[model samples]
Target chain A: MAALGREKMKQLEAQYKKILADYIVNQTEKNLYIAQNFTRQLIQKNISPEDVISIHKNAIAEIFPDRMNEAQPAYDFLIEVMVHYGMAHREHQSLLQKQAEYEMEMKIATSIQKALLKTHIPKLSTVDIGMLSVPARKMNGDYVHFFYHRDDYLSVAVTDVVGKGVPAALCMSMVKYGLETLEYAYKEPSYVLEVINRVIEKGVDDSMFVSMFYGCLDTQRNMFSYASAGHEPALHYNAKQDQFVALEAKGLLLGVLPNTKYTYQEVILEDNDIITMMTDGVTEFRGNDHLNSRQIITSVIRDNKYLSAQQLCQLLYREIEKIHGFDLSDDFTVVILKK
Target chain B: MASKSSVEIITEWDIVAARQLGRNEAKALGFGTVDQARITTAISELARNIYLYANIGRIEIERVDTETEKKIVVTATDQGPGIHDIRKVMEEGYSTSGGVGAGLPGVKRLMDSLEVQSVIGEGTTIRAEKWLR
Candidate 1:
């Protein structure tokens, strides 16, 4: 078997000598295509890459009898490097394939995440409402929903799941269905959180948890009733007192405990008063993982008191833009109600 | 960054919304591509984290034990004005004024047992342990 392999190798070397002579002569712009095509056949003959160097030297010597020392060790070294070049080229080709595949996946994920989280902000004449939600990264873990329970009440829920990506999105879809099922119960903030907690606890993985702030605005009564489940506090800007109030509530995080109950609180909105609901992504300036002073959100609202609700949302986002820039570290969300 | 003319990547993605937030930054910086703006954003974020957490909080990792099991525990401590009566918000039956509960109950269930101890003006220590079956 070994002798037969050697004879075949010798025969291939002779064949390569003839092929290399042809390959070099055909290395012109006009004959480049034919040269490459002929070389492909020579390569397909199972000649070892190292053997090509020796074969090339012999071929060069045979083609140019007087050009003796032209095929030296330098030529041998360069041809050996060509072996590496071919391997590297193949590796590069596969990498480009993987990159294209990844980019395609990212585009798909980005769009799906967008469609899942998309919702319309209602425009009301009596009250101007503005909202902004931005992901710190490509995937958003924050969830917001606005439900109009009746002609007089609009309920907004701001939720932030503990994790990110598809899992968090899956949790969000569950919460969405949970909220939708209790459309009639949107009037009460505590009950809304309670139902969401039950749904999350039952439907979501035990390892996951989410913080939520549910607020219902009674437009006719000018009352803002809200509840929270391990979420950030909503700020109340009293246009009268010229100060900000934190509407704080406490309850177990959704998916944390089954049969957990939440606390409800209500505040009457004086004319020109503002209620800002948000997730820790806004954190009223506390930041998602930091303990920033609550002054940041209030100061923006106070300084831009005359701006429309939409502008307020934009300005708050801009301010967060200052903290986070375009690549947010966490999903920053905010909803503003101006009366 | 306003993405006036977006790259032909994702179809029907928010065009106006995708406005060159990068170009916006690039425009602010005078000139550059979105990639350069991203590089700047990354460095700036690192600088921001250094500024924010320079002297703020710490994580204490230790081996802990409960009545039923042995486990490892992590306690994160932050030195700042604790936000609005957070201790009361953690009380079992007490309802938070308007903020979310401190998430103590969920912590309790995830761990085999959980213990919380705090001192007004001093600190709050939350300890929880998981039973390794």
Candidate 2:
């Protein structure tokens, strides 16, 4: 739309006509500068290019009556050019408006997604926790949900949806609500995983699938129970023996089958023992060429074993980011619980 | 059965040929009978898409063995007018309006992982991988 109203446009048009007539007489640099200023004013008024050409023709006809026949055809050709230019200018403005609308929607979506899987890390006197999830794009495919109701136990799950962007984000919301409906600590990790699996299979698309590692920590008993649905192997650091071992279980990725059974496993959490879980986006960060991403991730944890749980997660993420040149190919997530 | 095979798709017979190659590749890669069925169905869907849209393309079947996993990877490539909106087409209930076709999402369902790369005027290449569990 034109920046100026009808009266202002008419006043500017008269001013431009005077400026053009003066520039025609002298052709001085100062006159050229004045003409440039008129062009800017006309643009600010939202005067189309063709409208400028029309005003030029009127100025010429009023200034030189006998010279009209010679310049009329030339002005007509320029009017045709300006007509084409006007269409292109409007198209560009329309495209910019659409871009702004799309970006605004994406920003709103990002905030909604953040609220969908709100992970509140609990502060327990027995176990310290650290976690982080960074989406490569505006929408996140990887999510970490924490459930801590009783002072005696904490239940958590690290899940990754195979599909990316919006679809994956939506799928994760279904998982969060499903997990919430169940009573915590009383239900085994396997049951929680199976319920989420059934929920995803029924609600999501056939093409969509999810991988998850569900774990529950019993602080008073010093026990850790867990299950996996084709997710990445969680690493365990045995403080007493000073060793690292991968915690793995056999099960299909969720949403692939209606009643896929997941295997449940448990380990006693000795003093200062730590359990680290993550999605493929974290373990497969180095990609195909690097065969030992699991080893590298484990070593990072062992080397930085003394740091706080949260600090360990941040350091591991930074280390992976630095090695991968800061451009993560997928949604990255990490969660660690130290007892 | 070859570890890798490429089938040039031009006629309906080519779709059958690719399916045969997919079964053989699946068996050779140590996939069970149920997995073989899944692999062939995925192959059929991808081949049909190439035939319907790509007209003439190539379907490559390969057995990939990595340190951590073994998988059957199928790739369909063509130099044709590519897909305009890949994300829209991949969504559920999105079928090409013209006629009957299995669509790309079906291929994704039958396989373990699917990756599609399409340039509007350049070409399209789709790769589907099914890991042996």
Candidate 3:
């Protein structure tokens, strides 16, 4: 019995040594590679090395789920390495947990932000809306849209929140809510903006404001009513004349002051009239030279008047991408209303 | 309105994915040539926020048809610390970071219609609608 026991112990020892040696010599290097990458990310984020190790462990578990059950040994070894690297394991875990939490929150916020967009534009009978937008990073400041009530009566607006991250997103939500709440009270372009401005001032602080364009389209009347709040001008394309004109209306940005009144300007639409409303993302898009986004937008509209709204938007984006070579520096958005 | 139409993804504040998702949703709506780009832009901005602030979130896209209309509604939900003052958050230039603060408010200003509900420390829900006509 004793001989058998001794032999059994020897076999177990051999197996353990083999696995340990393989891990130390081969697996350890791979783990170190992953660790190094994770460390880079943490350092870039200004997180401590201990926190880096924790994120590394958590990330490893996720990427290699098959080995999650066996992660305890790996984690122990990581803890030892962290100590050698002059990091406190306990503090690192706490920081890692916090960082993980922050990352989770940002993910949740992005999901929420995506939800704010439309999966499909509502099909309308008389008016068609074509829109395109590219956000810079996860959350951007540019916003644009088309609101069609019926027939030729359409409302469109584009806004840029003053920032890029969470605060801007929150402010954007407020603007959305304010518009929904105040829309019924003010249907005219200027009135709607006036009410929105007041609501925003009441809700917002001095640091935040919205630069936007609000418009009401009368398809039956073949006219439009528009208001601007320190936003970019709407471009009007005349297919007959083969020309593009900018409709500029100057007003204070939303949330800047209470009871700020906005003025509306009128534009008549002819057959095959193309109207484009865009955010600053387009105007500010950097090309090899200073690519006037407005000029490119107008040209695209003139070139692709036959395409449908969605196609036109895509074509414009492709062109912009082509002009810049690749990638946009800002949140590029466009709203095209065809008559 | 159905569950199958929705999907969730995770990223580190990736603006490109947000834009792609917006275009994908528009494509799903069969808005191939029409002007759904503006609505997509609005959605992109809102989703970007979820990545920038919450760091983690869930996005839902559904083909919703009411008695009178058929459109797509996307909702981005977040469970971060939550906005302490939603009103303040909506103001442009009122950013905690140095960036221009045009994310959610800008989205609202873009969509056909928008709805927002938030509770501090709980989470936030943003709903935006786009018309197909």
lDDT of 2 at A62: 79
Which whole-number lDDT from 0 to 100 does residue A205 have in model 2?
92
In candidate 3, what are the lDDT values of residues B1-133, reduced to their tens digit? 3222443436744445555666666666655222244455566666667776776677676665555666767787877667766676665434334222235544554456777778877777888876665
Cα TM-score of candidate 3: 0.54
Assess every candidate by TM-score: 0.56, 0.66, 0.54
Q: Write the per-residue lDDT of candidate 2 for residues B1-133, one digit (tens) a residue.
A: 2267899999989999999999888888787444566678678778888888778899999988767778999999987788888887775445535322335655665577899888876778999998775
Tell me the whole-model lDDT of each prediction, alpha carbons only.
0.64, 0.81, 0.67
Best by TM-score: 2
User: Candidate 3 — which residues are off by over 4 angstroms?
Assistant: A1-93, A117-120, A287-289, B1-133
> What is the C-alpha DockQ of each candidate?
0.01, 0.01, 0.01
Maximum-lDDT candidate: 2
* Residue B52, model 1, lDDT: 39
Model 3 residue A146 distance off true place after TM-score fit, in angstroms? 4.1
For candidate 1, write residues A194-245 as lDDT tens digits.
8889888888789889999999999899988999998888899999998899
